[model samples]
Target: MRFPFFSRPAPAAVQPPVADGGTLLETTGLTKSYAGADGELPVLSGIDLTVRAGEIVALLGRSGSGKSTLLRCLAGLLPPSSGTVRYRGTPLTGANPGTALVFQTFALLPWLTVRQNVELGLEARGVPPRERARAADQAIDLIGLAGFENAYPKELSGGMRQRVGFARALVVEPDVLMMDEPFSALDVLTAENLRGELMELWDSGQFPTRAVVLVTHNIEEAVLMADRIVVLGSRPYGTIRETVEVDLERPRDRDSADFDELVDRVYRIMTGRPKDGRPAARPDAERTDPDRPDQDRTERRTLATTPLPSASVDGLSGLAEMIAHRDGRCDLADLADELGLDIDDMLPQVDALDLLGFAEIHGDDLLLTGDGTAFAHADVQDSRALFAGAALDVPLVRLIANSLSGAPGAAVRAGFFRDLLAHHYTSEQIDRQLETATDWGRYAGLFGYDAGRREYRLEEPETGR
Candidate 1:
């Protein structure tokens, strides 16, 4: 199902759909190689893929997979070591016309303001100044960055920075929009909001992309937004599975037996393991009540963290502004959207880290304890390290991974990632990427992980214990 790109497009009539299955972009047995310490490291080999006029396909795999290489080949960023890529029936040797990508990093020019960044795409295409301004305006408004055009990259929050990346892509009105974990750097709430807006624009025909090819590790995200899921096999790189025509239904029922069934299958295939050992899904609020589990479908937690009191207060947010802006905390709205919480949500997660002697929440200001701040700065994705010592006694990474993976459209609170480590993952992996989410939060942290004894023990830690 192709979600239309422009719900409320410009007054101009939409163009007719590009013919289906006629090679909007086609790659035959594509392969890529790079020079490594050992020399001649093969990245992608004999890869075959076809994207139609309006297709959104997900390339799913673990870290070290060749998804990035393939994306670069298609976008013409890197020349393929072997095989061929064809766009609109013509072979593509390099960055072809009419394609744009939004990367995990904003990669905006540090010196350029948001307005200049959005305008760069058009300027590259040689669009005249008058037309460039018009297109930039539309793209900025499209991504909700109307008044922010003049802000430099350093002045914007991570989420806003990402918008600049996206707006640059949209301002050109490319034929295909390719993104590599585009929201991976953002907070859950911000990612959801951006995704919601993108879906609305695409479906409404306001942003009619000819095709969109997104690459991500989050299986639930792939399932939710993609029309097809392409699973890549281990090592030496290539496609092992292409399961098209997924039938989970729209606004997906994650708790439904059917959704789990598909998720289970995909999880097994992607992990090189069978479906038998994976855990169930639950968030912190649900874990609080053992007898009464949180049910899905009716009212899910609206945000990822708890709300603050009725009146505005200082130190409600994190040390974020306290260090940069020189305040313990800031207004909820001043909080970074990419950081995922307003002042209301940030304080609790900060406190969660505090209770385990990981952090301190004083006057609503998030001050990471000595060790907490160290862990916050470390590389925490190592699976073994995630479970180290007493940080997590159970399968906490699996808990968080499953919660995010299974929840799909819903926001997995920031605390879900932090507290899960209280019970699961070796201290190593958690310290690498699982525990420190501010970096790769979008892809890895959202769907927490677990090895076995896989179950949802999602509970808020006993306060001040």
Candidate 2:
């Protein structure tokens, strides 16, 4: 049977394009940074991107990968620190007149009714009140909010409120629509339903925008909706690591072999494995020998270059144990499915395992190293010892332990490290680094953290030692 959206006819005013249209937006050498305590803190660098009239593009990445930042740049909401953002071949001076944004948080005026809220864009453009009302009604009806036009945002459900957001963006009829995690705030079923309906609208030529650019961290969501998926990499700074074209027909099946294979491929790319099953080079590495395993590249790491993933000892160890139970290897995608998690949710733990030399990713599969297998099988005391050695090898953890050891009275305020980290990271990122370090340090018995005092104290030696 054909997909529901596929069977529907286009609205009278809208017609399916005979062919793909021209470029709507483009970015060249786009780099962005913020001034920090030490120097410039780079978020994105050397980014060259484009969005065309007939395609839906997904910018996919992890938390620090700057997907939203890129979206803002494209929308002309945030100017690039260097390079250029152009709309229809003209360099943007301010907000792009051709684009409208849908935010993650609904961003509705609680005091305004649905029709009034949707009319905000039209009013700003100096559209007459009567014309604004007509456009808002059409948009509200098209998005399935026909009867709720007079209701305030508070009177509607979460899904309904978001429908207002979509209506508001659509009413403007911008050349490009920008969405930043628009469905992520909704429940799973709600998100799925909304996604299906939106795609149906696009397929049926009823969508108001000429093209779409979506910012998301969900791998499956990108595969299911985007005509092209641009994967961003975060390590030192954000860059477009790869772009995969989705050649599958519409109404993709999650259970189909081709769909599953594409998901697996994207999973591998996000985890540092290339399309050919080879490990990608570390962003911070200066290795002269290209044949060296990725683990060896960590020898040159520093706190700024290889900040710790926000993973706890218990969490990472549990992941290790799971892999050991699966005969020391498991497909990462399958493991995420079995655990009922999005693969992005499992990344921190998987990254922790790789960072600590406990595991390695070979294409789509996660393979435990010799140390990982031993640690998984070891008793508590032995596991602690193994973890201590591993943690010490990590730059940030080792720095904290050594800093406390050499301080007066074997203690130092956490603010000292925070200041050092501020040179490289934002306030939020610094907190995550410290929290992860604290967890790992305490677990290894390398140091102790006094939460009330905001201090790191060295662990005393055993009597015999």
Candidate 3:
């Protein structure tokens, strides 16, 4: 439940025993790909995983890391291009009665009341009306929505709607419950309450599900809920980087030293830094010189393989000022609490600042450099100039800017940039990257984009002003 920095790691439980049963779901040689203009774009590759009854497995990775893809495969919502997904020794074909999926959107029908929505699955199977109604009523009560069973989805709060989602999944008596960022959309207090309630249900053996597969971006949530945490990498395909078991007892202590160390260890793994204070090999094919610190920072700054910029300059500056105001350096966990941000929201801001050399991440704390401090206090024009300089140095930005400046009227078709980026990323990824570039360009007064003309043009001195 805490996002403390992990530094010292304790030994995990070796061969932790499954409380109830044997392997409930397993995947072998799991691979998934989408059809691209050139060929197939692989998302997952050779992922071998197993889940036993009574175990909770959390798949943790960045947003575009294919965590959701893997979960979809396991739930039989989407078929993998290649590989096998077996449920209790049977090859899973499509939606199975033994499996249920809880979505982050709380995918409920607004026209249906809570009880009716909960019983939708049973109705699909043509269960007797009386039997289905009884099961739905029981499930509603189980999830603490007993009195609200007659309320329509539109009448309930976000958390209540999500609880209805849980009840719907549970009503089916599924053997495996697959959750894709189930708590991400709820308020903090509500999410924590739901997490606690779910854990209690699992502990008491009161739920229909035997095992849970959770896909999340929150390392703290993973540590708190999972028996095993699987770290995934993003590149040609999503691959398993490492698997760690949580040895701590249930009802985990957020302030425990062991918890902090484990969280730190996961962070290091995610960032490609080893716990022994050594640089680990990046999962991508392009390798960087571990000896050159500048190269590492350079790699992050470029848009080569990074996701769309999720944080704006204003957001970054606000965080920098907060860091300077707090203590020149602040613990990331404490900062998240102060800023009212989840780990998912906080990471992108941290990464943006770090990539720009304005701030640095060390263990669990963030430190602002002298330039960063000055920028935090600078006027709007000064900040834009500073950001513009940094933006021009990025490889993709530099290439685009150079190409545009060389042309007549300092203009180039938007497709020119997309074509250039497609060589390095898929079409889908290229779209996200281009959108991010546009944001950065506008912020720094580096360029102007014409959506109707489908072109990018160099900005004059007074263009934005």
**Number of the top candidate by lDDT?**
2
In the order shown, the candidates' Cα RMSDs to the true structure are: 17.1, 5.2, 8.0
TM-scores for the candidates: 0.56, 0.90, 0.85
268: Cα error in model 2, Å = 1.6
Q: Residue 66 of model 3: what lDDT? A: 88
C-alpha local distance difference test of each model: 0.56, 0.85, 0.77
Could you tell me which residue pairs clash in candidate 2? none
lDDT of 1 by residue, 1-465 (tens): 332223333211143446655457778988776654344546677788888865677877755457877888998888888789987777887686657899999899999888888888667656676777777777787789999878899998888999889888876667788999998789878987887788777766677467788888766677777777887763334554445456665666656776655655665455334335322243533343222322341233211121111211123122422433433223222232335333223433443343233333332233443444434443544311321321221133333444644443434555445454423222333344343332112222333223243232322222111
Q: Best candidate, TM-score-wise?
A: 2
Model 1 whole-model lDDT (C-alpha atoms): 0.56
Candidate 1 TM-score, true structure as reference: 0.56
Candidate 3 lDDT over 1-465, as tens digits, reads: 111111221111122333565987889999998876457778889999998888899999876678999998888889988999987777888855467899999999999999999989878766677778888888888899999989998999999999999999887766778999999999889999999999998888786677899999888899999999998877545899889899999889989999988887787666555565344444432533212234444455455565554677677888888888876688776666556665557877887776666776665667776667767877888888877866765666666778875443588898887876665567777776677678778888778888999888877656753
Model 2, 246-299: lDDT tens digits are 998998898899888988988988897878976665562465442244555447
lDDT of 2 at 110: 91
